[model samples]
Target: MTEVDPLALDLPVLASLAGSAADEFLLARLRADGHEHIRRSHGYVFQRLIAGAPTVTELGAALGVTQQAASKAVIELEQLGYVERSADAADSRIRRIALTDRGREVVQLGRRLRAELEQTLLATVDPADAAAARRVLVALLAASGGLEAIAGRSVPLPSD
Candidate 1:
């Protein structure tokens, strides 16, 4: 193994790098499976839609983004055949977003890939170290209020 950079010793930097690498790995797998247009950002939308259909405005609020931004993401996903917008049954004027079959498949694939990644990590690290790392990560999330977001399945995407 190569010498680690001193800056990579920082928790936040190491976490970000690890996350990026994991995302790249997942994206590559998705592409190989014919999900070429999917991006990591789409996960934000998918996470919410998995629970139930929500209006763009509602989805925006859940994602902590502006309505227009949320609408843009929905449009992109709709174009990719991952999601669909339909008139709300209660109010035709209102539009609700729902995941299409393709979207659901991607979500399932992501879950499987995530489990595979975790298994790989467990295999690579000592059992005790893996348990400790999981505890530390959970504690960090709790300290940062990320635990709630994750529990609610509405973690916001970073601003561009």
Candidate 2:
């Protein structure tokens, strides 16, 4: 039997680790800014809401979660003042979920924090190298049929 090299992780594993690190950084900064109630999972909801208000069912479909689960999350976010549910303009029979002002602030903060993270990385990594890394990541995402999701800023939750 040959010993496996710990440094030779698969691309998915490496990507997940990098994403987790970035999320942690963003969360910490948000906490400092009084958004301690925000959680990483809320990102999926925010991504979909960014385009427009969506029904709970639509949100669940976008998140790849059960409607019940999506509703539960929305309820939690509503209580935290990050989101609100209102009657749909077209049909009062249906309700739509929208981000609150607090939610928008967190989203804007996250974008700025991500830009800062990139700048921090560039401080140590050459700009060309960073560009190449981005290209590689984009290519990987495209190959996995996720480019559209990225373009739409919608990321589904991972299946259990």
Candidate 3:
């Protein structure tokens, strides 16, 4: 007869641990060298901006966030001088958001920190195992609709 251990079958335990570890790592990297006002969601925003500068509406759509939420993020970013917003020449009503020097610096710092963190975590991990895990996570994210691009929005699990 096979023995079933509750701890081995506890999903919540695994989830809690994973969430805590991720939160700690994020906090460390974001706060690394006195960095501030950056959150996990900003990673996605940065990626989108790198692909190309986008209007707030376009950013919202690409990010899967509402226009208001996107605008609010832009406003905060603007206030921090991380990004600059200017009226579009072609469409005066629309505003274009671009990363400023400081924003770019923050993004680079974040990238370096993340890379270092990954290096630390993968120090002892077999390269094949790490590659597999990365593939699995990418697949899961895509399968899960790639997460909402905005804040305060819920992405339902597959069971629904």
Compared with the true structure, model 1 gives a TM-score of 0.91
Candidate 2 per-residue lDDT over residues 1-160, each given as its tens digit: 9996747988777887888888898898998989888888888889899899999999998898899999999999999998999998889999999999999988999999889988888999888988998898898898889999788777788666
Candidate 2 versus truth, CA RMSD in Å, comes to 2.7
Q: Which candidate, 1 or 3, would have the higher lDDT against the true structure?
A: 1
Writing each residue's lDDT as its tens digit, candidate 3 over 31-113 gives 76666667656656666666567899888887667889888888887887778887888998877888888778878887787
lDDT of 2 at 157: 82
Looking at model 2, the pairs that clash are none
Summarize candidate 1's per-residue lDDT along 57-160 as a digit string, tens digits.
99999989899999999999999999999999999999899999999999999999989989998999999998897888888788777898898897989777
Each candidate structure's count of clashing pairs: 0, 0, 1
**Regions of model 1 farther than 4 Å from truth:** 1-8
**Top-scoring candidate (TM-score):** 1
Query: How close is each model in CA RMSD to the real structure?
Result: 2.3, 2.7, 6.2
Backbone clash total for model 1 is 0
Order the candidates by lDDT, highest first — what do you get? 1, 2, 3
Q: Estimated TM-score per prediction?
A: 0.91, 0.89, 0.69
Candidate 2 regions with alpha-carbon error over 4 angstroms: 1-7
